[model samples]
Target chain A: MLSQLVFGAELAYGTMLYYLVLFLVLVLLIKVFAWKPINKMLNERTQQIVSDIDSAKQKHQEADSLAKQRQDELNKSHDEASTIITNAKQAGQKQQEQIVSDAQSDAQTIKDNAHKSIEQERQDVLANTKNDVANLSIEIASKIIQKELKANDQKALIDSYIEGLGKQNESR
Target chain B: MNDKISTFFLGGLTFNIGNMVAATVAAAIVLVIVVWLSRNLQVRPTSKKQAVLESIIDFSNTTTRGSMSDSDAASFKLYGFVLFVLIFVSNQLGLMLQVDVNGVTYVKSPTADPMFTMTLALFTIALSHYAGVKKLGFGGYFKNTYLEPFVFWFPLALFEEFSNFLTLGLRLFGVIYAGEILLKLVGGLAFSNGIVTIIGLAPIELIWQAFSIFLGAIQAYVFVTLTSVYINGKISAE
Candidate 1:
């Protein structure tokens, strides 16, 4: 058999032709059944992965921005709240000072009015005492003079002088 | 060994029906398996079968791209894939079982014959030349392939082309043919003395069969690798 292969074996042209045809058919079949669809699928999967990664990155950026915005709002509100508290505290302090000042002025006015009324009362009391003294002297002098005129007539005279004195004091 | 090939004459050409049948069977097996594995394929593969299929395709792609640019590899990858599958299957077919009726072998490895391997080698070389011409014009192709480095190297380059074709085809034929012959010789040991020979030589036969399987796979790889290299040689610039 080896000798025949080396020396006596004739070339098989028909087998070659058959192989050519078979190989071509096989290529065509594989192209339709395997290569086309598989290659397409592979390319599609790659594209899908790329797009998914891109979308994920975009979403991550969006989340970061949103978080930053929320933090900014939170910070602003915190500042606003502190300002309001400070403003309220300042207004309360001002009101407290105004109340204290008003009370001080009211006390001063009360003290001045009390002093004026006391002075007026003291002056009235002095004038009344002077009138009482004056009346008492006049009565004493008239009584002494009547007593020396006559013992019997002196009583009548003394009574008349005292009456006059009383009248005079009433008219003045 | 008696050389008996079943021949039929069609027109002026003689065909080896046995080899044609065997080759066709091998091709059919490859086609069915490939088509089936390719069916219901998802973008995200889930099945072990799909993984196997993808690995096969990846193996072919990687092998081709090793010798050529990705752009060039794209066109020839299917060719490389088909060549590898067909050759691999054909090499293993005879090892599984060889059918002999009378003195003619009805079933064997199609690649063991000189005619089929030579045909494959011829196609590969011719396709390379065609691609070379397509990539570079005819004048450029000629100068690059034969007259490169020095004009004095033309004869040697020409001789190299012939030798490349001869070696590529004959190498496959020689290895497979010799392997099959050794297998037969080992198998003959079992039948020589009935039971004792069968028992003792069974291990030897088994070992040789395993080795032959390994050889077939290697030869398939070598063939595809060389095919890509040849194509790359022609298409790429110095």
Candidate 2:
């Protein structure tokens, strides 16, 4: 067998041609049927994966920005709410001060009016008492003088007597 | 030692019928497997078959890319894949079954024959030169292939090309042929004396067969790798 392998081995043109034709045909068929479609599919899958990853990243960034925007709005509204509450509290304080001041002034005015009216009533009562005393004195004097004297003489006497009584009362 | 190959003469030219038949069988097997595996392929692989096919493609792509630029790798990846599949199937075929009828071995590994391997090597070398010439003009291709680094390296480079051609084919032919020879020798022991010899040599035959299968796979991978390397050497400036 070894001698045959060494001595009998020779190149054959027909076999070479046959193999060449077969190989070329095989390559052609594989290129058309297998390699083209398979390579295309692989490339498409790679591109799809890349694009999918890109879109996912874009969505993540969008979600992040949206969350940030919502957070900012929440912070802003929180600030506005606090400011409104402070304003309402301040307004209520002012209203309370205004109401207290108004009530105080009204009480002062009513007290002053009450004092003036009491003083006026006291003056009216004193004047009426003085008029009544004067009338009573005059009536008493007329009753006493009527029983003691004639007409012209009684008038002169009574005046002199009254005058004498006023001088005597003043000296006493 | 008395093995014979079937042959015929047509128009005063000798044709090796056994090698042709074996090569055709190997080619058919490869085609069927490739076609079946590649059918119904999806972007997202659903079946283990698809995964296996994708990995095989990926492996070929990576092997080619390892020796060439991306653009070159892309152009040649399918060639690399086809070469690997064909040679691998051819290498393992003899391990599965070797048929002999009336002192003539009709079926065996096609790669075991020098003619077939040399033919494949010639094809690869021719393709590399074609690619080199296409990428670089003829003058540039000659200059790059024959004269590079220094003018003094020309003789060495020329010798290297001849040796490369010889070695590429001979290496595959040697390993596969040696493995088959050893397998046959061990198998001969099983039928040599009696059942005692058969039972005793069964383990050795099995081991050798297993080793031959491994060697076949390795040779196939080596052939593809070297092919890309040689092609890359031709096409690329560096």
Candidate 3:
């Protein structure tokens, strides 16, 4: 009876309806066993991804702070460098001005010294000319007196007077 | 051709070569695709094809892990691959090929065959028992079965086994077979009637065909998914 019931077909012959039961059993078994693993794996994967994302976000936050601090330090260094450069430039400019002033002072002093030397030389020349003129007058008078004395003593006396006149002319 | 299909096996089983050929071709195509995709899998997804394959793998893995404990989930991968290949091939067989002998042409979808689907379902059910026995020794497996109802209802346990197998096989085979028959009937009518059939029945046939394809794929997925669930239940049980 069970065989008849199992083998019975509503349609034509060769219709194996018993296989339907076998198929259902297979599907039920799969539903209980295979599906569990797949679902378990999915849940685990989702959890893993969630945790990974959280950790990633945390790491990113940490890195962001470090970057900001480094940027600040860099900015500070840049500012310090600019200040140092500005100071150096100012000092250099001051030194250049001082050097220029010193050069001008030295030039002015040299010019004044040259003027004094030229004036001193002019005075010395004038004094030497006056001495030369006096010397020449004295020498010419003595020579004329000596020559007249050789000719005659009286002539020599007149010659002295003439010499004196010549001396006076030379002096003039 | 009909006589060829109805030829006697060792028992009363009728073997259809056309159906078997179509199934074999489909299976071959499935194997080739698996080899092609898996051979080229990369650490990092590249092309759309690779990405699609990787995503499928990833989805399967996640599903396996979610459905079973970590230990059982590892084994679930093989089962998933088998189920996927079997169903995909069976579903695509009729769609891909048409075999004609004399006047009557036949396109037998492998999933439409009760024998093929029944064998698959039986295999799954048997595997479930193996998993149960392996996880909970032979004694424990029997103990769980008895615990379900009154201890005297041991026979019901055997009945339950048959019931599961029946539903799994019939659910798939019935849907596929009926859908195939409907399509054939409608297609024959349309061809014979031409423009008049298109005006009257074409839309209905198209809708049914589309829905049947959807049902076919869904049934395969549901069957495998339930199988995995059962396996996980058996193996993971304390």
TM-score of chain A of each: 0.66, 0.71, 0.50
DockQ of each: 0.61, 0.47, 0.05
Q: TM-scores of all models?
A: 0.85, 0.87, 0.57
Tens-place lDDT per residue, model 1, B7-65, is 99998877988888878888888899898988888888998878998899899888867
Model 1: C-alpha RMSD to truth? 5.5
lDDT of 3 by residue, A58-108 (tens): 999999999999999999999999999999999999999999999999999
For residues A1-172, write the lDDT of model 1, one tens digit per residue.
Answer: 6645572477878878988888889888988998887888789889999999999999999999999999999999999999999999999999999899888888878887788787777777678657766766666676575456668787787688678767866876
Candidate 3, B204-237: lDDT as tens digits? 8878867876886787677777777667656654
Q: Answer with 1 or 2, whichever has the higher lDDT.
A: 1
Candidate 1 vs 3: which has more DockQ:
1
Candidate 3 displacement at residue A27 in angstroms? 19
Q: Quick one: best DockQ, which candidate? A: 1
Where does model 1 sit among the CAPRI classes? medium
Q: Report the number of backbone clashes for model 2.
A: 0
Interface RMSD value for candidate 1, one decimal? 1.3
Q: Which numbered prediction scores highest in lDDT against the true structure?
A: 1
Report each candidate's C-alpha RMSD, comma-separated, in the order given.
5.5, 6.5, 10.3
